[model samples]
Target: MNLGELEKAALQYFWSHEEADAKQVHAYFETKRGGSLNTIQSTLDRLFKKGLLKREKQGYAYVYRQAMSKDAFIGELVADVTKDFFKPTENALHAAFTSMSSSLSDDELSELETLIEQQRNNARSE
Candidate 1:
């Protein structure tokens, strides 16, 4: 499922905060970019339609929670990007790693190396 920028932002907000009401989401976005409550509500409704969000009636307000975990959602998004833009090629994966590796800390790089070694070992075993 393709998510618009506003829907992605709303989902991220709910993911980070656990749960949020429309008013709170509206205020959050308004601070970042001036938008009416209707806009936020519409985007949230769209997210609901996309099955990315679940809403519960809390008193007079609706509280929203993410339907998918952050990691799962990110994995799905990455898979979609790889499929559509990268065609699942080794060059695409290498480019992504190269771009991201520059930002990795020493510990992160060590962990990545370990992960690569483990994967290599697994491939050999298979």
Candidate 2:
């Protein structure tokens, strides 16, 4: 499921809040971008069509929740991007790691190194 910026924002809102009404989502976005209620409604409709959100009737309103967990959705998104743009190449992985490394703390780098060693050992065993 390819999500647009607004869809991503909407999904994140639902993810953080557990459940959100259309009005709440609109209000949240309004604090940032100041879009209309109709705009928010349309974006929610698009997210629903894309199967990224589930809606349930709540009184006179609809409450939205994520159709998938955040981690699962992010993993799928990363896999899709890798498959589409990187052809699952080691060079792409290297670039991603290098880019991430620049932002990591010393402890994080150490942890990543340990993870790499574990992956290498697993590969050797395989």
Candidate 3:
């Protein structure tokens, strides 16, 4: 899904904080980003409509939080971007991961390897 700058910033805020009303979000962004409360409210509404945020009415205002974790959002974005061009295959996926991992440090690469091994073990059990 496409996201505006404010939308992305608002999502970041939700990821870091538990939940917030529009005014609180505006307060957080007022100095750093300099947008009005209406803008913040609209951004939150848009995010809620897009299913990126969960909101429920609290008194007269809505309190919002992220619908998914940051990693899940990123995974969806990666899948969305790659879906059109690639007919995913094991080798293709491996190649893509290897290419992406090229910039990783040794420790990060080892962590990735451990995760892969854990996935393999899980799959075998399943």
Clashes of each: 0, 0, 0
Candidate 2: give the clashing pairs.
Answer: none
Worst 10 residues of 2 by lDDT: 87-96
Per-residue lDDT tens digits for candidate 3, residues 34-104, read 98899999999999999999999999999999999998999788777767667755445555677899999
Q: What is the C-alpha RMSD of each candidate to the true structure, in Å?
A: 4.8, 4.8, 2.2
> What local distance difference test score does each model get?
0.85, 0.83, 0.91
1-126: candidate 1 lDDT, tens digit per residue: 777888878888988888888899999989898899989988888888888999999998788889999878886776667666675445666666788899999999999999889989999999
Question: What lDDT does candidate 1 reach at residue 98?
Answer: 88
Off by over 4 Å in 1: 83-106, 112-126
Residue 106 lDDT in candidate 3: 97
Residue-level error in angstroms, candidate 3, position 12: 0.7
